[model samples]
Target: MSKSLRTLLNEIAACRHCVDNPDGTSLPHDPNPVLRADKSARIAICGQAPGTRVHSSGVPFTDPSGDRLRDWMGVSEEQFYDVQRIAIIPMGFCFPGLDEKGGDLPPRRECARLWHARLFPHLTRLDLILLVGNYAQKWHLGKERKSTLTETVRNWRQYLEMREGPGYMPLPHPSWRNNSWIKKNSWFEKDVLPRLKVEIKKRL
Candidate 1:
């Protein structure tokens, strides 16, 4: 039989593959795999790898981006972090480090290859998964994903309407850097946020 979710999480917590084996270059810093996985949760906030702030905090979404994501979902801080209600599963469990431009590098490929397929199957109560950035959308949506993030997120309704499996909601990353994109995409607030709230409320 497969390992229990708790056991799997324990293994993941002590994971050193990124630094020991690695995908390409080992992580620049010591490995700090940051993610949350609770079997009781009904919704999973699927996001990219941890940034500097999250890496330091070790708690997921403890940054300004988190505040915006909470607003987008119309939930309070308490509601967002409730382990029984919401799960935070990012593409990469660790901080993949920064590029020369100072932007965070992409999520480590090792993370998904090693853990995602194994972990997701254990989340039996999950009703929805919010694909919260390009990396997440790409991995989860696969060949079905649209050519661009905007297109994938714009077609969010289709993913939610699926007859089988957890509903998927594509959302842009809520980083402060995306403020310009958010301003440009007025319909996201006018059209998407209402539906997102409705879905969240239903599951909670």
Candidate 2:
């Protein structure tokens, strides 16, 4: 890793402010977070927090979900791990623990506020930012978003209708839960998937 990357990681790890709770975590989170690459990355993959496996392993997208993500992007494991080509930055840095229903909870509020502004400056040559999941979409799209995620994604064209170059593309998290949503939204299969593959091919 470069000196700048190492310095940034240390800075993030050293930050102790409880911007979300102020009282501190009941179950403390892994403050040290992994995000993006060392400045040469062209594609940025922004998703939700790290899952259990990811947190434990300290490698993003090491589970089945990552398999699906790689498949969607039409990239091999070698390419996906190449930080110079693909950068992985989640909305939340640490694992936010589980919910009452046994599902993973949402990302922390403080993360984006603390890191995004700091990190964005370093990504000088980012060509495509893959906004995976609602959290990323909300941050990037903001007021331009519709009432719901489905609506926002359905109207994804609005984000690209006016711009050129490999711009932002919002996607649902490639978890098992979204399989039904993917099936229901035929346009994803007919329109988005094909276009996505074309984009990946161009980058590769």
Point to the candidate with the largest TM-score.
Answer: 1
How much RMSD separates candidate 1 from the native structure?
1.7
**What is the number of backbone collisions in each predicted candidate, taken in the order shown?**
0, 0
lDDT digits (tens) for residues 131-165 of candidate 2: 89899999987887778888877776676553754
Off by over 4 Å in 1: 1-3
List CA RMSD, all candidates.
1.7, 2.5
lDDT of each: 0.92, 0.79
What TM-scores do the predictions have? 0.97, 0.89
Worst 10 residues of 1 by lDDT: 1-10
The number of clashing residue pairs in model 2 is 0
> TM-score of the candidate numbered 2?
0.89
Worst 10 residues of 2 by lDDT: 18-27
Question: Best-fitting candidate, measured by lDDT?
Answer: 1
